[model samples]
Target: MESSSDTFGKDDSADAKLQESRVVTEEEWLQKWETNNIGFHNEQGHPLLKKYMDIFLDGRSGLKIFFPLCGKTIEMKWLADMGHQVVGVEISESALKDFFTEQKLSFSEEPIPGIPGKLLKSTTGNISLYCCSIFDFTSTITGKFDAIWDRGSLVAVNPCDRERLVTIAEIYALLMLRATLRPPFYVPDSEVKRLFGKSCDITCLEKVDGLAERPKKWGLDYFWEVLYMLVLK
Candidate 1:
């Protein structure tokens, strides 16, 4: 199988090809941490998430969950405490290394075929970090997750890739049988219906307070915003 990383050459635009070519080789992506340039990384949990997590999750346990663009999120550990297995896909090895170090656990790594990915294993569950791109793993990963968590994935990426992101989210909803929330960006209901059809049900739509824009550091204009939660028929 061809590795997913091999599918898209480095430097491909995030909005290119809609599905096949958005993967880009971004050395600067990791700079957010190396230079401490992260404006979107929230130190505290999302307030809206805290208020409604139970309403959607209902104390569910052992559900497989996916967190795309997950960057050492403390929420993953929180989910683990509730007995859910969390799977995160991240591109930056430095961030991943820092996360595990902070967690104080040793992780085992292995390659995945037809994709440029290294599977990281912890006692809680296995996390597959794709070196290639998100789209490549879409077809490889099976058995839909109970929930998909997005803290900054959507908002962090350039807006032109919105359609592709929706396609991925739709596929995830079909496989997992549930959709939790994709935050920091607002995906329109019309677009959701257009992609998944009008039969799809929206579970929740709420806005949470964001802390990235305090005294306006890092040239950020942070504003807390609404996010989408949808379920497909």
Candidate 2:
């Protein structure tokens, strides 16, 4: 495993810039979805989620799972089908719509009062998606969840906003994320501890090099994805 400094160092300007670019505005994310530039999405859902299902469930069922920065991820459907209530917060309206349409799930949208967007709920009421900035979608709005699956959400967050986010997590949130570099895009173990250690007990469940074919796509010689489970104390 590379040191956090090695991952976050500015020695590679191109890599640094590429990672920095991921901290884009909500509009930019919306544009990415509109143009179908979502290579971050996994069509079959995340393999780790399946591989570690036992850990997440812990011999329990009827979990209320949460997904942050969810972009038409098929994982939500998978959990809902298993009789768990799935709640997700997404910035792109189109992404939310695509999730329902692609999953062939009947849903209804109701304007979320005081927000710029609406809440889309499946007809079965097992899955709920709120189209709004993640920062705006608070626990007060959606209540609590048994666990949070933060695949790409934390990595895409602006660094300046990270501390505030960590502070907010004091009230709610915990789990894993995907990042190529450290800090704004990639968060190494040290970064994870630095951000959440004070409020949560952090455990790194897994860390692996990116897929053999993905380095070229992300413009990096190597990319790493680390999955951590955080329990707020």
lDDT of 1 by residue, 1-233 (tens): 11111122233223223433344335667776678665556557555566667654756667777777777766666766677777777777766766778767677777866577676767445444344456566745555667777665654554466568667776665322222222323333333344445545554355444434452553434443544555566
Best candidate, TM-score-wise?
2
Task: Please provide TM-scores, in order, for all candidate models, with all chains considered together.
Answer: 0.72, 0.85
Q: Global lDDT for candidate 1? A: 0.56
Stretch of 10 with least lDDT, candidate 1? 1-10
As a whole number from 0 to 100, the lDDT of residue 230 in candidate 1 is 55
Q: For residues 1-233, write the lDDT of model 2, one tens digit per residue.
A: 22233233454445544564345776777798999988788888888778777777777689888887788999899889888999988888899999999999999999887767789999999999998877776777877677777776667777667787666555665443333233236554556777777877766666666655645666656667766667777
Error of 1 at 92 (Å): 0.7
Clashes of each: 3, 2
Those runs of model 2 whose alpha carbons end farther than 4 Å from true positions after fitting are 1-23, 174-184
